[model samples]
Target chain A: MSNSTAFSRARFAALIACFAATSPALAQPSTVGFDQISAGDTAWMLSSTALVLLMTIPGLALFYAGMVRKKNVLGTALQSFAITALITVLWVVVGYSLAFTPGSAFIGSLDRFLLEGMVYLKSSSQLSVSHIAPTIPESVFVMFQLTFAIITPALITGAFAERMRFGSMMVFMALWSLLVYVPVAHWVWEPGGWLAAMGALDFAGGTVVHINAGAAGLVCAWMLGPRSNFGKDAFLPYNLALTLTGASLLWVGWFGFNAGSAVAADGRAGMAMLVTQVAAATAALVWMAVEWLTRSRVTLLGACSGAVAGLVAITPASGFVNVVGALSIGLAAGLFCFWGATGLKRLLRADDSLDVFGIHGIGGLVGAILTGVFADKAIGGVDSHLGVQALGAFATLIYSGVVSFLILLLIRSTMGLRVTPDQERGGVDLALHSEQII
Target chain B: MVHDDKFPIAAQLFIRLKRSPGRVIDVTWMLENELYALEVLKVARGADAESAELAARYETLLRNRKPGATAAPQQPTAFARTSSFMAEPEPVPAEVGRHYVGSLR
Candidate 1:
């Protein structure tokens, strides 16, 4: 061979070696099939994990904390904080297995118990990819889905705030997550699952997260009864400024909630991002306009709630609808959720503190039904299918509602659900947690 | 010990002691809580050497240690208290009046 050809060959080999050294997987020919996975997609999902987790911690915590009365501020915030820790542990142990692993149609198996087979420590290591989220590693998918699981139960805490026994509340959440959330998640998101086979399209958990949690919240509100004063007193929010800050974070983080569901950094993700902003803006304005008409003044609280309502409504349709479809859904969510919070609230006679049922329940229903109506095949959906959407929403509502009530009933009979009236009157911060805002 | 005429208030306390000695001790503690210790001692001094003898002895020592004006009577009606500026005030909570302080150095 010529000396010039030898020199060229050596340079080519050096370039190839440098590229391989960039990532841990690239350093060795591992057993896990790491070749087919998209680096951009994996990176985006990892970032999405952080963003979704952010929604629960400071975002939901502050949003709830600011709305509660002064004495219960710390108590309320700590519930979200506690759930984040608790749910993460549960997800690590078995939640990931039961929700994402291949098993029966309604629920998954414990095949990945304690997250086995997720890491590749040897040269022959092959990464586990969820058939549903095939482009990303199973661990990344697990972390992403775990964030959803954490926030769903955390959302339920808003219903029974300032009144439930701390021990009982903890127990209730653990049971409810395993029994209600896991099955619904498996049915809807898993490919071989019943709802997914039934052609139900829940892009980012409109039915599972919002409707399921919302229905459970309604049951809890009824079972736990109302805050002591209920209808007789005016319970004002403690701090709207804190609420505003939290709402802003939730708004930003929700792009991860919806757009991240695309599981890719592609055109679909781009459209999801654009539609999310549109719906939020539209719903915020419509809510303000209607609120101004009914009440004398528009409020910051009104705008924030409207924005959230829009976000919830757009969730199921984020990947399926166009700009026009998104606007229509947002407008409907604002109008419906406002009434759900006020008129339907009075009608139900349920306290539903923080309006979880009103916003998430009503918003989820509106979005799910509308996902059926607005999902144009030209955009990115299967043929428009309202019947399928309604079926999915109805099933989630019934299952979560009944199971949550039964769980609460069992807990109520055993450990008791509420604190003593004296403890409540003094404030749950000091009563339940021995903590006071001051 | 049953001289109701010489010491009417003390005689009343003795009568209460007759019904329940435990209750009388509890009443003394209540009086100690609601009235000045020295003031309670002064009133107890004239009482008969009856069942509240232990209470009376404790009051007498408290009286000698900090002699002051007699305490107001415990009654159904609201009692007005003197506002003493000389006593130390409690330290305010950090969260309280925080906005007023504005940017600590």
Candidate 2:
């Protein structure tokens, strides 16, 4: 590693060590004593955070860039990289504390602004234990959750791919993260929040990440209108190889995503990993078979899209459901998401540039609802109601949709949202960033 | 809100270009706003070796055009976005002259 990289590694090690020693938590009444912190679980969570971050950078970036036309390739990828940095800044400044700290049923406070407790950490050797996660250090949990915060809004970029001013997108993501992602995250993940109190199950962010991004993506698509040549033009993907590579990375990294949500390297994590695999495989086959029947040929794009569908569908059910549940959800996700991308795309007529609504949105909505049905109590010791799951799904759709629409409008009014016809024709990469594949 | 019809800008934003069968060069944009027009030109050229020379020429060209002159639509620039494998550029309106240039793709 380079000197800077080595220094960062050292800095991170020190921080983790500081977090490992939970001196402040001894005073709090808790089952897991402050004397004990699981190094094994901390190690896993740390790795999981890196994996999730990877999902966005090269993984998600390559996936989006490959799907867009050659001119739009770099611009599409740039959004993901830009969001990762933007969200990280927001997360440290106030996002983490507001979403995770105690305040009301809907939102948290600025008590931990700038990650105050984390950086200084009360004499630099001690850290507080979050009520939600008793075994792992709060620092570990915070870093892990921050990764989720980064990717949610980044996923929405797929909607208004070739259009959308970059400045408008940045502003939209910043506001959306604070207004939409933070509140929803608090509701589902934070123990004191409404959704958690109501016993809604989101193993790894079906509602907060996928559903929220998908809904926002739909609204953004509607707000931005279609790409200039939507109905008339044939915009073929620039590269399937890059997309396939990205999808493969997403599949591999997802073990960390689902299993790591367990917050432990225990039996639950093992089962979560197993279910993830089962569901992804089942969904891929189902999507391919359906595509073959429909188009008389099974395209590679269908297979990759299928895998992502399964991942999104199983995300909420990963911890609650059994192997049987995984298979069922995966199969359903393949069939449903296939329809979502094709039938729904035609029905909506909105140029969701990358099927964000059709795949992630539809899949997440279905996944959340199905979690209620497939959430076998005997397997994961959690029972779910179908109504409650539907409530969570619709709640996210309404909240993200309305909020995202307003954010987009605000951005549009302020600094012109879409690029000019000249810029669009020139390609956003060359036009905006002055970069091209050549 | 600078409406095209309501508020006529003193400068005419028009690109003057020459194109051969396979290549295009010496594209000059005449506009009211010098800095902004140069910014757009820089975006397309992007730190190329010839960028400085081409920009200087465009600056000299823009100086010649009188302000508020109506610009007829120009032919598509020769170096329009084209993928090696894909023949046609992205589709737009029926206008802009070139249609389905890349017949193979």
DockQ winner among the candidates?
A: 2
Name the best candidate (by TM-score): 2
> Where in model 1 is the C-alpha error above 4 Å?
A1-31, B1-105
Docking class of 2: incorrect
In candidate 1, which residue pairs clash?
Answer: A31-A123, A31-A124, A31-A125, A31-A126, A32-A125, A32-A126, A32-A127
Q: Give me candidate 1's TM-score against the actual structure.
A: 0.76
Model 2 global lDDT (CA atoms, 0 to 1) = 0.78
- Residue pair clashes in candidate 2: none
What local lDDT score does residue A254 receive in model 1, on the 0 to 100 scale?
A: 93
Off by over 4 Å in 2: A1-35, A119-125, B1-105
